[model samples]
Target: MLQQRFFSATSSASKYYKITLRRSPIGLSKDHRASAQTLGLFKLHQTSYQPANASTAGTILKLKELLQVENVDSIPTKEQLQANKPDRGYQVIGKKI
Candidate 1:
């Protein structure tokens, strides 16, 4: 019915728009930090992807003032993402995960 179609459309729309935080926004304006916080991005080089919707796109546009974004169609899962990066800086701090 109508509900099913709506759900299907939402599910299909969930597969695009990869948002990556290529650089840190430290020492930037408070507004930039707030935008990043709104997007759930707090660390450097932390990347997240959302559906290509108006709200998400708008958030990216706001974040662009302090971030480097690439329009990738997809992004790796959190686990896959953690596996690729080395623990160089953390090793000195005696942290390994």
Candidate 2:
């Protein structure tokens, strides 16, 4: 599956699944919790990406009750996602010896 994704991603038209956890799955069934984990969602309001494919579609279906999903033209790179994160209001300088 990785190899297939790798090759397909070389094309300019790659797509992604923009999945966000809209509600906590904390008190849900075990199946719900496992599906949430499968989608890389473990916290409320957390967002993650998955390749837009049939398998992901099936998983999304299983967790449809808890997720907000969309098909995206392209997945944001990690650096891009990081740039959009809220600042911690501090920066590291140097370690004290």
Candidate 3:
């Protein structure tokens, strides 16, 4: 039998992280856009959350290289989400991103 230790499916200690795209790489290149798209991040001020696992970590890491990554406990409220939007001047209202 084979053994695995990186991340177990039966584990119950998984955490969630909030990933946001602060800046837009519109004029950067195709590669950057593809990277953001792969992480489900396209438009600026867009946010997404994922389990704190190796796969998620890898995606976050990739985005971090270009955008920003922040670990959050729970999903942000509607107001909270809207407050962090670009129109709000990208303010740090609800929480840091």
Global lDDT of each candidate:
0.69, 0.86, 0.71
What residue pairs are clashing in model 3? Answer: none
RMSD of 2: 9.5
**How does model 2 score by TM-score?**
0.65
TM-score of each: 0.51, 0.65, 0.53
Selected candidate, larger TM-score, 1 vs 3: 3
**Model 2, global lDDT:** 0.86
Top TM-score model: 2
Off by over 4 Å in 1: 1-14, 68-97
Residue 69 shift from truth in candidate 2, angstroms: 0.8
lDDT of residue 47 for candidate 1: 62
Query: lDDT by residue for model 2 over 1-97, one digit each (tens)?
Result: 9978666544455488899999788877898799899989988889999998889989999888788987788878889989999988999799999
Steric collisions counted per model: 0, 0, 0
lDDT of 1 by residue, 1-97 (tens): 9988665654334455655576777887888778787776878777666666778778788777556655554667789878998866543656678
After superposing candidate 2, which stretches have Cα over 4 Å from the reference?
1-14, 82-97
TM-score of 1: 0.51
Clashes of 3: 0
